[model samples]
Structure formats: C-alpha cells, structure tokens
Target: MPTALVTGAAGFIGYHVCEQLISNGYDVVGLDAMTDYYEVSLKEARHARLESEKFTFIKGYVEERDLLMGLFETHKFDLVIHLAAQAGVRYSIDNPRSYLESNIGGTFELLEAARAYPPRHMLLASTSSAYGANTVMPYVENVRADHQMSFYAATKKATEAMAHSYAHLYDLPITMFRFFTVYGPWGRPDMALFKFTKAILEGGSIDVYNNGDMSRDFTYIGDLVSALIRLIDVLPERGSAPAGETDSLSPVAPFRVLNIGNSSPTLLMDFISAIELATERKATCNMMPMQAGDVPATWADATLLTQLVGEIPHTKVPEGVAKFVNWYRDYYKC
Candidate 1:
C-alpha cells in the first residue's frame, strides 16, 4: 500500500488527517511527542483510538534527526504531512525556545530527510497568524508576510521560507497551507471553543479577549481536513499555482501557500453565544483588552484556496459549535 507520513498524528487536526488517509486506502504513519503542552491524556486518547491494522504510530519528537532520517529511508512516503509545532500564541510569549526547537529545528530536520528521500508531495502546515499586523481584511496568500506579531507566527512563516528553499534546491513537490482559526470536535484544549465549553459547563466565567470585539475566520476541523486531502493530490509545479490562474502559489518553486479557512469571519460575541447555546448555559463573561502578541481579528481570503482545491469550507458556526460541545460532553461524561 502507498504510505503517507503524518507528523503530530495525535494532535487535533493530525488525528483527523490520519483517519481520512487511512479510510482513503493509504497506509498511514503518525509521529507525536505526547507533549504536556495542553493535556497528555487527551493526546493519548487520540493515539489510542487511531491504533488500528493500517495505522502505525511512533511516539517521539520530530526534531530527532536520526529517527526521522531512518523513517524516511525505510518508507519512501508518497506524501509527508508536517503538522507538529509549538502551538499557542500566548505560550510562545512565555517560552520562545519551544518554538525554536519544534517549529524551526523540527522543520529543518524534516526537510533534510525529504532532501535525501523525496516524497511525491509534501504538505507543510502554516498558520494565518503568519499574516501579522496586516490591516488587510480577508488575508490573501501572495502578500509579503514578514511582520509576524508573535514568535509562533514568525517560526511558522520561517518554515515556509525554509520549505520553499528546499523545494527550489531539491525540486521537492511541496504545498504549504496556512490554516485559519480551526475549531471543532476533539479540538485543542487551549482553543477558545474548548475553553468556553469547559467554563460554561462548570458555571465559571470565560475570558473574552479584545473586549469581545475581535473576529476570526473560524475554520471547522472537518472542512479543513477535506481541503487538505484534496490538496495532497493537487501538487503545484515550479512557477505556477495548480491551474496557472492564482498568484498565491509560488513562482520560483513547486511550492504554494494556500489558506484553508471558512471565508466567514464571525464576531467574538457571536462565537461565545454559539458555545452558550450548544452547552445550554450562559457564560459569565470577562471581557478584557487584547493580550500581547495576539491579533484582534483574522479573516481569510480563501479565493485562491477555493480555486486550487475546487471547494470551500462551508460549515456553519452554530452547527460546528454544537458538534464540539456534544463531543466535549460525551468525552468528559459531563
């Protein structure tokens, strides 16, 4: 069976990606460190569930050069989906070294392995936060993203550059996707939807950043995974987007950065209200100023993504929020 390597397999989106690949008849391999950055139990749960006949998992850091190199040598992967990173904007402010090790160093190691044994296509995960400090509504992919507000965004952006260089030098077919605020069932604990659900369930106050005035292009996890699957098959050639119509794709390398987001940007209060309705409870809100290194809003111009993938993320906010709340309740036995 053709093999696909998915790093951060136990992660929220990684787990979903792995499941989709396996269902589509690809032999899937997952690598995760099981870091305590959020909750180890949650990560373990995801890994345990993915333990099946066709899925093989390795528990280790991607920065481990020998392990990665060995894996690449042993299994010439048809596709490598790199999703592991030091996530969380606030966390990067406290400990930037984690970003350096996981984001920069890990990416460097992965690229080196790919250099030796090139995959048919390599999909690297980036973030919308990479479009930092830009007043541009509905952020586009072709624009210069040099001014990242957070170190987390900086590292993700840096990896995009690094991957582009590798593609240019080795002629590796690569697709870099900049994800918007992805949220849904089995979501990350650090994310707003999850936190708000937990707090509301416990009858506690939830912190609303930017004085509840912020908005985000909240991409549902299922929609994001679908786009990724479609994109894996739509590899770009050097100096072109997939169909030679979009500019977001790179001109120098077989690499392009596509935004995977629901083009609708919902207000913060509305997002909180979705969770409240889903949980059947009202949140005691604590509206506050924008935290450092955080953007007030994020909206994705997914025109290029739609053009390349021939689809757009169309999940409704209320429905997605309800799915997450149901999962949360069942998972925690609340």
Candidate 2:
C-alpha cells in the first residue's frame, strides 16, 4: 500500500481527506497538534473515528522540525498533504504569534523535511482569504493577490510562495489549493454554518457580519475532499502548462495554485435562510458591520480546477446546509 503523510489530520478537512485516502487503500500517517483552536475534544473525536491499522494518528505540532524530519525519514511517504495551519482571521489579529508559529513556521519545517525525502506530490491547503483585497469576482488562480486583509490570509499566501520556492529548488511537485468558505458535516464551530445552526436552534440571534451583505462560495467538505483527491494525481510539471489565462503554473517550478470552490457565490442571508430551512426555524439576525480582516465577499473561478480535476464543488447551499444541520442535530443532540 502507498504511504501518505497528512498533517492536520484531525482538522475538519484533514479528517475527511484522511478517511477518503484510507478508503482508497492507502496507509495514512496522520499528525495533528490537537490544539484548543476550536475544541480539542472535537479534534480527538475526528481522530477517534479514523483509528485503524491503516491509519496511525500522532499528536504533535508540525513546526517541530525534529518530529517532521523523523517522520519524513521513516515514512518516505508517497504523498504529503499539508493542512495543519492556524485558521481563523479574527483570531490572527489577537494572536499573530500563533499564526507565525503554525502557518509560517510549520510550513517551513514541512518543506525542509520534504527536501530531505521528497514525495511524488505534496498538496497543501490554502484559503480563499488569500485573495484578500482583490475586488474581482470569480477569483482565478492566476490573479495577482498582493493585499491581504488579515494576518491569517497573509500567512497562507506566504506558504504558497514558500512551497513554490521549495518546489523550484528541490523539484518538489506541489499543488497549493485555496479553499473558499468550506462547510459541511463535522465542520469547525468558528465557521458561520456551525455557529448559525447552534444559535438559531438555541433561539439566539446569529451575528450577521457586513449587515448580511457579504457572500461566499461555500464549498462542502465532501466535494472539497473529492476534488482534492483528484488533484493528487494531476502532478504539477515544469513547462507543461498549456498557454491559458487561467493556468497558475509557475514558469520556473513544478508548482501551481488552484482554487477549490463552488463557482456560485451565495449571499450571507441566503446561507442563513438555508440553515433556517434545515432547522425548521427562523434565525434572528443581529446586524453587524464587517469585522476587521474580513471581506465583503469571496467568489472562486474554478476553471483551472475543472480543467485539472474534471470536477468542482457543486453542492447547493440549501442541500449542503441541510446535511450539516442533520449532522449538527445528531452530534450536538439539539
């Protein structure tokens, strides 16, 4: 069986990816810090579900160079998926140190380790927030995204550059996929869907950021996982990019960035309505201005993703929200 090293395997996306890899007959070594970023128990629970002979879970920080080097030397993994990073935009403002440590420092350690024992392909998770202040709708991967609205996004963008340099110097085939507002079953509590469901179900008002005028290309977890797995085979090759405007392939390296998202952007209030429909209850919205490090909207241009993977996140808001609500009700007993 092929061996894969999945960092942040306890996270929402990490857990699903690891589960899918195992189902596909891969022996996965999962590593996570299990920090209290959201809830450690939830992370533990996700890891618990993956316990098996094929999946080995290790609890540790990815920034620890010793741990990563030891694992890379031992496993010599066929594939490496980097998903462990300090998430959340608002949290980055209060605690920039954690972002530096996890997002920036962690990526550095991973790249160094990969340099020693290179994998066939290394897929790293980025965010749509990396688009930052770009007002252009349907963000294409080739777009120049320089102005980041948050420290969280800036660090993610830095990782893209970091990975590219490593890929260029060491011939590390890397795909940095940026995710737009990913949500689904077993989602993080800090996200809108989870928080909105919990509040609306408990008869509390949900905070409507940007006065509910914002929008997002909310990609479901299942769809995201499917598309991501597909990319593992679409290895980036130097000088193989077709001359297209949507191609984000680097001219100097076997590296590229792809936006993984539902191309359809849904309004924030519409998303809340989906939640209300799922819960069979109306949500009281507490209108709030846009928070620091937040954008009014995010939309993805997944042409490159489709061209490479032949699939995109197509789950509608209502359908995805209903799936999440069912999971929430079952998980939380609400």
Candidate 3:
C-alpha cells in the first residue's frame, strides 16, 4: 500500500480525506493539533471515527519542526497533504500572531522537511480569502492576488510564494489549492453552516452577516474531496503547461495553484433558507453588518480544476445543507 501523510487529519476536510484515502487502500498517517479554536471534542470525535489498523493518528502541531522532521525521517511518504493551518478570517484580526505561527511558520517547517525527505507530490491548503479584495466574479488561478483583506489570507498567500521557491530550488512537485467556503457533514463550528444549524435547532437567532447580502461559492466536502483525490495524480511538471490555458504553473518551478470551488455563488439568505428547509425551523435573524476582514462575496472560476480533474463540484446548496442538518441532528441527538 502507498503511504500518505495528511496534516490536520482531525479537521473537517482532513478527516474526510483520510477516510477516503483509507477506503481506497492507502496506509495513512494522520496528524492534528486538536486545538480549541472551536471545540476540541468535535475534532476528537471526527478522529475517533477513523480509528483503524490502516490509519495511524498523531496529535501535535505541524509548526513543531522536531515532530515533523521525526515523522519524515521514519516514513517515506509518497504524498504529503498539508491541510493544517490557522483558519478563520475574523479570528486572524484579533490574533495575527497565531496565523503567522501556524500558517507561515508551520508551512516553512513542512517545506524544509519535504526538502530533506522529498515526497512525490505535496498539496497545500489555501483559502479563497487569499483572493481578498478582488472584485472578480469567479476567481481564476492566473490572476494576481496580492491585495489580501485579512491577515489570514496574507499568510496563506505567503505560503504559496514560499512553496514556489522551494519547488524551484529542490524540484519538489507542489500544488496549492485555494478552497472557497467548504461545508458539509463534520464541518467546523466557526463556519456559517455549523453555527446556523445549531442555532436553528435550539430555537436561537442566527447572525446573518452583511445583512444577508453576502454571497459564497460553498463547495461541498464530498465534492472537494473528489477534486483533491484527482489532483494527487495530476502532478505539476516544469515548463510543461499547455499553451492558451490560464495555468498558474510557475515558469521556473514545478508548482501551481488551483481554485477548488462550486463555481456558483449563492446568496447568504438563500443559504439560511436552505438551513431552514433542512431543519424545518424558522430562524430568528440578527442582521449584522459585514464583519471586519470579510468580503461581501466569493466565487471560483474552477476552469483549471475542471481541465485537470475532468469534473467539477455540482452539489446544490439545499441538497448539501440538508445532509449537514441530518448529520448534526443524528450526531447530537437534537
């Protein structure tokens, strides 16, 4: 069996990735910090569900160079998926240091280890927030995204640059994918779907940011996982990009960035209505202004993703929301 190392293995997306990898007959090593950003128990519960002989779990921060180097020395990882990072746009404003430590510092550590013990392909997680302040309807990979609205996005962008330099110098095949508002079962509590579900179930009010005027290209977790698995095989080759393609392939390095999203921006209110339909409960709305370090909208171009993966995410908002609601009710016995 091929060996793969997945960071943030306890996170919402990471857990699903590990599950899919194990099911496909891969020996997976999973690492998670189990941080209390939202609820550590929720992450623990997700990890617990994946316990098996094929899945090895390690609890530690990826920023720890010693821990990461030790793991690299022991296991010859064929593929390295770096999903662990400090996530959240709003939280980054209050705690910029955390983002620096986890997003920038941690990624540097991973790159160094990968240099010493190279993996076949290294995939890193980036956010659509990195497209900060861009008015582009559907964000394409080739566009310049230097104007980041949040510290979170800035750090993620930095990692993209950092990864590219390593790829150029060491010939490490690296692919960085920017995710656009990922949601589904086992989602994070800080996200809109999870918070709205809990509030609606408890008959509490949900905070509708930007007075429900915001929009997002909410990619379903299952669809995102499928895209990721496909990308693992589509490694970047130096100077091999086809002509006339909007490829973000680095001219001097085997590195590229892809945007993985639904490509359909749904209104915030419609997303809330999906929750209401799923839960059969009317939400008391607290229409609030857009929070600091938040964009009013986000949509992905996803042309490159389709060109590479041969498929696109097509999960409709209502259908995906219904699945999350069902999982929440069953998991919490609500």
**Which candidate achieves the best lDDT against the true structure?**
3
- Residue range 1-334, candidate 2, lDDT tens digits: 9999999999999999999999999999999989998988898889999999999988899998689999999999999999999999999999999999999999999999999999999999899999999998889899899999999999999999999999999999999999999999989999989999999999998889888899989998899999988888999899785536779999999999988898999999888888988999999999998899999999998888888867655998899999999999998888
Model 2 vs. true fold: TM: 0.99
Report the C-alpha lDDT of model 3 over 103-131, residue by residue, as the tens digit: 99999999999999999999999989999
Better of 1 and 3 by lDDT: 3
Candidate 1, 52-83: lDDT as tens digits: 98899999999986888999999999999999
Q: Which ranges of candidate 3 are over 4 A from the true structure?
A: none
Taking every candidate in turn, the Cα RMSD to the unseen true structure, in Å, is 1.1, 0.9, 0.9
lDDT of candidate model 1 versus the reference:
0.91
Clashes of 1: 0
- Which candidate would rank higher by lDDT, 2 or 3? 3
Error of model 3, residue 297, in angstroms:
0.6
- Worst 10 contiguous positions by lDDT, candidate 3: 241-250
- Return the lDDT, model 2, position 138: 86
For all candidates in order, the CA lDDT equals: 0.91, 0.93, 0.93
